[model samples]
Target: MRSLARCCARNERRRHDCKEYRRAVVTYYLGIDAGGSHCRCRLVDSDRQVIGQGESGPANARIGVEALKATLMFACNQAIAQAGLSEGDVARIDAGFGIAGIGRPGIKEQLAQLDFPFRSVRYETDAFIANLGAHQGADGAILVIGTGSIAHVRVDGRSFSIGGYGFPISDEGSGAALGLSAMRHALRALDGRTKPTPLSAAVTGRFDHDTTLAVAWMDQATPRDYASFAPLVMDYADAGDSIARSIVEDAALHVERFIEAVFERGAPRCALAGGLSHRMRPWLRQKTVERLVEPLGDPLDGALLLAGSP
Candidate 1:
């Protein structure tokens, strides 16, 4: 009878251990692509099946660490809720974050203090994630043109970045740059230093042709504020405005230069990924255009990969 009791006890202990093992093995994955304009999150199971997704406000590191954390938390909670997971489940998740301005001094250290309810976490720059996803982790290059511009390339396990400096002094082939140029042209036209076309007239109309008011607005304008006028430049260019066309063409040259530099560094493939990518495609040289390939995925996908990294 004692022997039978010992066998039953052993069976019970084995069952308990099995249950604990299963619980410990179950894992969830979260990927966050945190950009200047918005933060997006994706939750997936161990099998790589998406369970939920969410979005929130800007999480740019330049916006201040607290603000970035708030936006990231908002996105994370929404996704977790949508996945129908309990609060405790958050602690079982592994997460990866791809954030804009992460390369800025002290930003990485600042992110370390963020309270993420995950089993583990990884962080990478937005440009790296974009390039990673575009090529699906293979060696390649990506030129990202949005409110700002940056080029990233990976080749033979090494990474290189070019032209990611913020607006005014850099970010030459970016929406902010294009828009700023348009505003400058408008100012010149107002002073009779340049011929006023439909583009200049429309831009000047926003300030009632008052150079003083325009200058005042610009004095405190953020990059997003300047980028808001990019569509106007593109519209005017499409309408055959000479000044607008010149501005766009100039921007295209800068983009081409980025591509050439990337290829010279031995990247076997290249892609354009960002809000302005498709819009600028038509203006690229046929030879340059031919070298481009469709991105395999996006930054969010790259962020997911980071979650699985050691």
Candidate 2:
């Protein structure tokens, strides 16, 4: 149940009838879509209007389990309050948790340790929800390239994914990876180890003209910090920085590998989502488009739909 301290005194919105029976039920659904930098919880009726919403901080597994629980609790409680519902009412509500941290070791165990008040719980990697949200229960694949990256294909409710492992060693074409590449280039330039580019200037200027400054920043910075610099890669690339352009091009290639993996599963349609989704679009290879997709809905909305459906 988390905490009722976040509850509201009045209902936020009215419920609607389920089309199947021509009967209006008081039931509602809750959806929590968590990320590396922010978490959002949405409440909706069977009809899928966003009746209530709440947001909190990052829930990435790399943040550790304690932080994950805290963030989920905070956002979920806010959503309960916003929906004008109480802890007890949630016992009848179905909830779907599409979280960034789910695929990590000990994640399922840690989540089971928590005591959320949902009547039922369906947990999955953020990538699955991203695909469902984008595909709307149809058979298709979705690539989510945010702080991390994963690609998933959905056929009738079953899902399969590729490459959502983590940073440096995995998660190709992700924001974290992009930033790491940018930083590598920045360091090389600073150490007189490589040719000059605006990226060096940008990185140096961003950190007060000292690449060493990033060491301390990195110590405090989560994956989000690395992902944050992903834009810098694009910025430099747009300005004709050869290294930056190369990074983006290489990233596009990495991203395609995931698409290819999904296509290998016989996926016919595909869509892209997350921070890097649109950014990588212009650079996407022609074959990737041969397996294109039109998104079904936003992830938050998809969460609500999953919760509401029987």
Question: Cα lDDT of model 1 overall?
Answer: 0.88
Candidate that would win on lDDT: 1
Candidate 1 per-residue lDDT over residues 1-310, each given as its tens digit: 9999999999999999998777567789998988766789999988888899999976878889888888898998899999987666788899999898889888999889887779888999888889988988889999999888899999988997888877778888788899899999999999999999999999999999999999999999888788888888988898899999999999999999999989998989999988888888888999999999999999888898888832
Q: Which ten contiguous residues of candidate 1 have the minimum total lDDT?
A: 19-28
Model 1 misplacement above 4 A: 1-24
C-alpha lDDT of candidate 2 relative to the true structure: 0.78
lDDT of 1 at 47: 82
TM per prediction? 0.90, 0.86
The residue pairs found clashing in candidate 1 are: none
lDDT of 2 by residue, 1-310 (tens): 3345334312222222234233334577888888876888888766666677889988876777777878987988887787776555677678888888687778888887777677777777777777777867678888888888888888655678787777768888989888888888887887889987888778767788686787778778767889888888888888889889988999999988888788788787878889778888888877676677768787876676566553
lDDT of 2 at 280: 82
